[model samples]
Target: MKRHTAREKAFQLLFQMDLNEFDPNEELHEHHGEEEIDSFLETLVQGVVQQQTTIDENISYHLENWSIRRIASVEKTILRIATYEILYMEDIPTNVSINEAVELASKYGDEKSGKFVNGVLSKIIA
Candidate 1:
């Protein structure tokens, strides 16, 4: 899978996991059906899950006035995904992560989500 497609799928899987309390394995199976899971997709989902606490902490610190819990689920999920890539995936450029996250936000979240994601990620990257 292309990185873009993998990232989007990872966001969907993680979003379901966060909102519906679905198990990762179940979501993965459900999402891919009989197809082999993309390695990057699996990596993104697992990496976000494994490093969630630290990622949340990083986001919380970078947030201006809003608490991490106060952010909408979509925005929070996008933030976590981008933050995970920024912090852990040395091969992907930080700007690429941030830009992709903003795209995800614009597609799946409210109109303000893109800017909100970009702002928080900018702070995190700094």
Candidate 2:
């Protein structure tokens, strides 16, 4: 799978994990259905899960007027995944992470979600 696809899958897994409290590994198995998990996908999910507290804190810090709890689940999940990549994955470019996150938000979240995500991530990046 392309890294983009891996990131999207990772986002989906994180979203499911956030909403349903499912284990990321279990969700990966259920989603993949015997296919091997892509290494990047595994890394993304594991990274987000392991560093969620710090990631959330970063997100909470950048959010303007909106609390982390107030962010939509889909938006928050995308933010978490992107934040993890931006802060932890040195190999990934900051613009790539931010752009992918905005794409995810545009695809999975409300109309304003992409803009909202961009705003928050830009703040974090700056």
Q: TM-score: which candidate is best?
A: 1
Q: Model 2 misses residue 79 by how many Å?
A: 0.4
lDDT values, one for every candidate: 0.93, 0.92
Off by over 4 Å in 2: none
Query: Deviation in angstroms for 82 in model 1?
Result: 0.2
Among these predictions, the greatest lDDT belongs to 1
Candidate 1 lDDT, tens digit per residue, 15-55?
88888886787788787899999989999998999999999
Model 2 lDDT per residue over 67-104, tens place: 99998899999999999999999999999999999999
- Model 1 scores a TM of 0.96
Residue 49 error for model 1, in Å?
0.8
The per-prediction CA RMSD against the true structure, in angstroms, equals: 0.9, 0.9
Give residue 22's error in model 2 in angstroms.
1.5
Model 1 alpha-carbon miss at residue 77, Å: 0.3
